[model samples]
Target: MYTSTPFNIADQLPKGLQALMYRAQGAMDNEASGLQRRSFLKVVSASGFALGAFPLLTQAQAQAATPAAAASALKPTQQPSAFVHIAKDGTVTVTINRLDFGQGVQTGLPMILAEELDADWRLVKSQHGNADPAYADPVMGMHLTGGSSAIKNSYTQYRELGARTRAMLVAAAAAQWGVDASSLRTREGVVIGPGGKRLGYGELAEAAMLQPVPEKVTLKDPKQFRIIGKPTGRLDARAKSSGGQSYGIDTRLPGMLTAVVAHPPVFAGKVKSLDDAAARAVPGVKAVLRVPLDRGGEGVAVVAEGYWAAKQGRDALKVDWDTSTVEKVDSAQQLASYRALAQTSGALKYNADVSPLATAPKKISAEFVFPYLAHAPMEPLNCTVQLSGQGADTKAELWLGTQMPGLDTLAASQVLGVAPQNLKMNVQMAGGGFGRRGIPSSDYVVEACAVAKAARTAGLTAAVRTLWSREDDIKGGYYRPMHVHRAEIGLDAQGKILAWDHVIVGQSIIAGSPFEPFMVKDGVDATMVEGMKEPYDIPMRLSVHHPKLNVPVLWWRSVGSTHTAYVMETLIDEVARSAGQDPVAYRLQRFGDKHPRHRAALQLAVSKSGYGKRTLAAGRAWGVAVHESFNTVVAYVVEASVKGTTPVLHAVTAGVHCNLAINPTSIEAQIQGAALMGLSMCLPGAAITLKEGVVEQSNFGDYQVPRITDMPTVAVFIAPSADAPTGLGEPGLPPLAPAFANAIAKLTGQAPRELPFKLA
Candidate 1:
């Protein structure tokens, strides 16, 4: 009952592009070693010619009796959560269950399964799975990937799938040898019998398909893991390192043109009218496509043959924009609006009444504000799409680096008027994502599809459209909202915290977007309270969220905690000052009584940093901040001195996350990376405000990130955590601003709350 079906998809590809997939090899002489059943070979030798190959799936065709492809015509544009393939040669491949924006999980996650399956690590590969409902996030509605849930969400399911595959192979081997299944056991790339009979994983792969899926298969005990705990280099590192990797900018299809877009000078503005005659006359210009804002939000864009040409054409064209809505949208206005709103009783409320303040009459009330922020990832947004007409291959192919591929696919499909399956999205390595790339709406994808559709009429097939010059991305509309917190804390004379009331006012980031269902509720946005409420064992506390007067906001690197943690930790420092207590001691006392993990991190940071010790420079002081985010706890001690009134940081000592999929080394690298990113935001990185609207700081030059010169000597200590691997990428970022602010406050008798601290 064994059958092998072979069909060629090469004909569907361009002339020189053969199928990218191939079969792995099995042991030739050793029939019983079971080694053939476990190993997915990287290279196979046949007819004296050695071929190096990797797992490449070219969409398998269903067998005669299996579910017909048409019957299973899943709306590919919808979104998929999980889509994996197991080749008959023991090769295993998984679509990216989540997005990768340089967090290294695109390589780390597949390693999790290979570790469990005991598959040859080198041979395992992955692909970008299109969005579908089946791939929907268990927690979120659709197959969306954000909120540090990539590994956490897929932990058990990926292992189960791998284990199930292994069990089938074992069963197939048992049937082949006419032996009881109990006699066989799987090891690294092999299955062994009681009498020493063994078979390779590849040899049993085809036969394994005939076996029924095991009702249940035992997962490996953590102690028995071979590859899961071992540190493996990134699977895509070589390709990226050698400059062989193809990013969205490298996407090329037959006759595909290039495109650039001209958006409004301000956010939420409408294009009144534009003349594209001059743009259309450009040498490479094909069509001056007018992209309208009516479909989704605001602004109009122009399409051209090449990005530079599009830019040239855009500059040459004349247009008038209705900036009525944008005129009232300034940072100061937003801040004041949020401040007033924070005083109101919002639809969603927590820690509402300040009755707790009565218990301790000497309460502290402070207002903290964090300005709007931009996710200036290195690679700007780019998408390449190729769309054919209805009944004329109605499919569109997309190549881009997006944290929200599922959403991108769905949006692209909607614009193209095709099913999701008709759209193929190649998820590329993001130069950086940092919450910005997880845009729920596929605005960029839609724009690319629109450009491609227009180009198709002129015989253009492969068109790539890129958005964002450093100016464009920095001034981009989706922003980390300017947030204001009106926080009041009541403390007894002895500094024993009694009550806490925190009210955060900011734009409703999720109110009307695709993420609204999970993010917005009762006028409360969860992101607004992420780090606003302490996990401390406070006697009485209330956290509240107040929506702004209809302004736009989005998630930053640390999401809500990007600002909330700063407010919470800085306010705690103020409380310590009022009580005449050491800042570290106060946090330790409070956290020790409430959260052991938080206390553990805080103590480790203090102890390792030599807290209370004098630095080489006189008038220099140190301040500490501890925050928990993305399930990882982190603490920082920033040592600084006041140059005039501005604080110049000299060194940073941090005791942060230890739970990791890889090891302490990788964890430290991520922590360091996040620390630098955090510093930039707190220093010269926040978006500036002007009379017109948000002004462009423009790239890393004007909107400076922490460079080697700006960076301090950082010491990272990993508090050993046996807990499940928590996120180390973002948690380190939340504490940097607060620690720096607290340090400056100690050096000078001023509690600096406003970000980008300037003493003048």
Candidate 2:
């Protein structure tokens, strides 16, 4: 039997990728042995690689990136040298610290940097960075891209990086021509001397690196921005459009072997016995070995020459699984348990008086059920692990679209018994991750490493790639936790909320991970209640139950907002209807002066969609929802018409107030994609149900998602502002389904409470 539970995914899902990176080498509870959080960050900021007044990357450093010199990030007063690399041919390649898994940071981040660098827009390109410290998030001090933090957190950092690169080029040209650097200027990748002499960045690049990175540089003013606010195309747009783009799934190494694991039907179920006689007889079969799985599970990995062979070999295997010790979670039974818990007191998050609920003139009680959801990224889950040498002196290289390379490196190092410095992670572009690739456990990476280790132990010297098929991934654990929300509201005669007693029952996304100490407080996991109450300003007595079920839950697209926004917005619209007020007007009334962003976004969507000024078609009705997540506000105004049992979405207009739109096209793309994903929640077969601890849906046939046929005509309008840009990758998704739900309610006099629409 598998070992008893210790630290699992709830601990790893984290509060959107914030974890203790310095203490990753030891046990989950090892907090005191490593550098304290604040102290470690201070050290990194103070003494971390300072590229100021030095070559961006020395010849030796350029050839190899070791852990001792891993951090190349500059301080506030220093200049960034690692992110931007100028080629000899004048092509500028910007290394993005975050994974560009369809979020469009592939171009947005570089736009910000290239704008300040005064580089030729046509020559700009982007690539993903490795596990080096230079690529870590400035705020979190980890190599993370979740929480829509990529552009938001790196905005100013990239701006300064570009500016400093420009300054360094100027200095290089100045020194070459023996002129005062102050007398020189740069424009469109060229350094202009006093006599109008121009030096292309390409000609000055080598010299520029030899010169020092400018200690202080001037960032471009918003009005002077040529690239930042433009609707620039993604660096990989043409490749993606032409079907030539390479994802992590396309990784190919010389003599690399493919692997497919035969996991137990039940999560964390142990393997009692196995017979690989048929598997071994198959041609191209390498070897099959029993290995430990994530969260204390056991499975057999089949290694072969190719994916088809591995899959075929896996299909031929026979094994008996012991699931007696693990949880056999039944969806129906879990719902029953959640329903019962809704009546009891749980961990108090927000303590507001709910006494008015008993005697208020108006009252509404509602309950919601959201089923477990799989990420189901197009790329599936694949990690290619290559190891050379053995044991302590062994060196490793990994290729994958990993969300948390820092943690992955630590986990891989321990698994292969290699030093952190000896390992190199080649970050690849992912087709889509939503949140699967960024799991706290680095499960996929560890599994791949385990398979590679097992292969080497079996005398197979080639690199091994552990690939999960569509079935394996869909049935894989670490899904969006199913949530049950109960809300009892007390409202005044005018539709103003007087009191809201709310209860959310779901597994904590970050309960046991090393960061639990910092995130979960007083028995409350803040992530579980993110979008519960806000903007509208209402007294909400919020409580949550972090039930310990065997199921592992992680953050999906927008984290908790995936469900919270739906619950909050639909309930808000329902409350508005009960008050005999127009949902839009009622929402505006509630906005007051405290939420001008929300009000403006809503007004923008209304005005843009002609929501109130124009009449809809015969069967059409307007649905509106506005929510703010990750410091960005998105308002959706949609038209819906019901056809029998199906709710037909006609059109959608989005109003986004994210302070700044770095690249209008990228923003539009994110919103368009996110809105479509949001629509998925209402589609049939959208829910992932567990029966007897086994996932009932194994692939897209049983577990459905939003397809092109389901998409509505969508238009995105961004609010104008000079403020630093906020995130767009996730904010657009939270309010979409709720807005659609609100519209469906307008057509039919009922508010939908369950996802995948159980309406008859």
Candidate 3:
């Protein structure tokens, strides 16, 4: 069902002002309708004012009886808008509002819309939506693609859009046939009517544009769905597999020069002096100019004919950095400080008296350390910017795979001294983002725009494409914040949680971000404390310390769940073992009846993996963990064996409860990918470190990711549900490490408390 954001008038506003505000809001809703009406009128008027012979359904009946409108109570704040485009050749192009960074939203969203549209699957295609106000997320009111919200937020919206478009087409066809619109039906790309009459949607496109948009339209029921819930192949699989897909890194404009910047070794360090003579002497080098970097630092960008030339010029450049302004962050020192801070309560998140901890039957005090982690998307960061015009008429265009295109456009506009509307962003497909592409500062995009503006000022008059080498991309800041967690737990003989006191010390990701005002409250960053004590409902007291450090930090894939899930799940497993009970049963007991999804998912994994019914090999053991992130629950039952001093995962069975899987194949792929990433976090040398304010690792050689050999056999199972879909991208990640670690703990009799486990 269509759901629109309700307009509420403040008591302070005058009646006249409130009325004006309502009118403005209504205009926004009707914007798409107006466009559709104009197109339809033009077609009908041009066709000698020919009218359809069928009677249209009354607006009231259409609004009340439609399954699509009644299914969802929360509708789009604005009208169903700019996504579907039908070509005369019957090719239907659907524009996705979010970045397609391997999470399968590129195909999943279209499946939702196309299912309701009843369009021919073979004729359907998809494209990335540009940074336009019309494409803003209906709920977020901005361009964003993180937190695995792409499908969850836009599921109903896209479905309504398809239903509306189909209704309009039916109206057009009914008019032409002089039949009742209610008697019309659509199957595949054809409209069917009495006497088996049929017409392709392409033929009715022009006339359909003239029909008034139905405020409500019927949506297909789950039993009737032909697209969603099916194992459909990705729309872009062929292009990507065939090496024909162009990511942000592949963007190239005529006369576009490649740029590589030599940044300060220290975070926010400035260049005291520069020597560019040798750099300029390099052939193909166009210009070398100092530019402002993210975090108020300074860098020199070298523009050249190509990437190789830019790198050569950048490598040839020399600069003396002034590091006096910024604090030199040493990883070891920071860990020491964090450990000390974790001993004391800083800002209270959950305040429950834990005085009973001393008297509990069983007690455990644990300290866990999570090091900084780089996002390290497969494709390195890059942006292409072109500037035109001058002064007030100046226009700027950008090409990049941006997670927050609107934010990037705003940031680029500020950097180039242009209006946001004048700056155009052409969204491109991304190889993979995890969370790197959604930086709050739009660092890489702004840097590219700065280089373009500087090049234009220097009479270069070419589009500048700023690219980051592998080393630069890895060493560049904005890694996940390092954290130290200390927990003191008291448990009863039955393995039930009695009292728990926890303290976390880490850098705040949202402190200086535009989202801080809303995301951070009462001196607590919500992202920092999510997944602390949940599902089991045994929270005692939790406190956090947000230490402002020179090392830049941002949200990783699952944000706080990355660490919290490990802590919670592992600790719960430990408690179960200590109580002489099965871990899965213990979890189920604690879950009681409130967490049916969690119980169902864990039960599915257990039943499928034969956790209690099957015997393990001589050297192997079972591990199980369940977590909910992004409103989705994922449970993993893993088999692992310890070889020498290292732990090796052999197989994994996953039970996912994301509700109504849009594409079962995509969900399976995402789970497998996330599981591997989780395993990557446990491998040695996976940490991102800082020594005296300089990033230690530079590339894959030092900062390791999982290779194909490291992957285990993963089997995914989805719980049965017809409820609204939840996010699948990140939920699969949080449970993997904890489950793997639990198995290792069983083998070694010691629980791992740090990432990149050190069995030695």
TM-score of 2: 0.92
lDDT tens digits by residue: candidate 1, 357-436: 87785788788777777777888877877666567458777788877665677677677776665566676767886877
- Of candidate 2, the 10-residue stretch with the lowest lDDT total is 1-10
TM-score of each: 0.84, 0.92, 0.91
- Put down candidate 3 lDDT per residue, 1-760, tens digits, no spaces: 1000000001132344324323433433343323343444454345321222011111121232335533434333323335666766667777788999999999999998899889999999988876655465665666678787888888988898889879878988999999999999999989999999998888887667556667767778789998888888999999989999999999878988999999999989999999999999999999998999999999999999999999999999989999999999999999999999999998888998898898999999999999999999989999999888978989888899999886787688789998665666888999888889988799998888888888888889888999999899999989989999999999989887889999999999889876666667799988888888888778579999999989888888888889999999999999999999999989999889999999989999998898989999999999999999888999999999999998899999998898888899899999989999999899999999888889999999999998888899999989989999988888889899999999998999977999988898
Model 2, C-alpha of 154: deviation from truth (Å): 0.4
Candidate 1 lowest-lDDT run of ten: 1-10
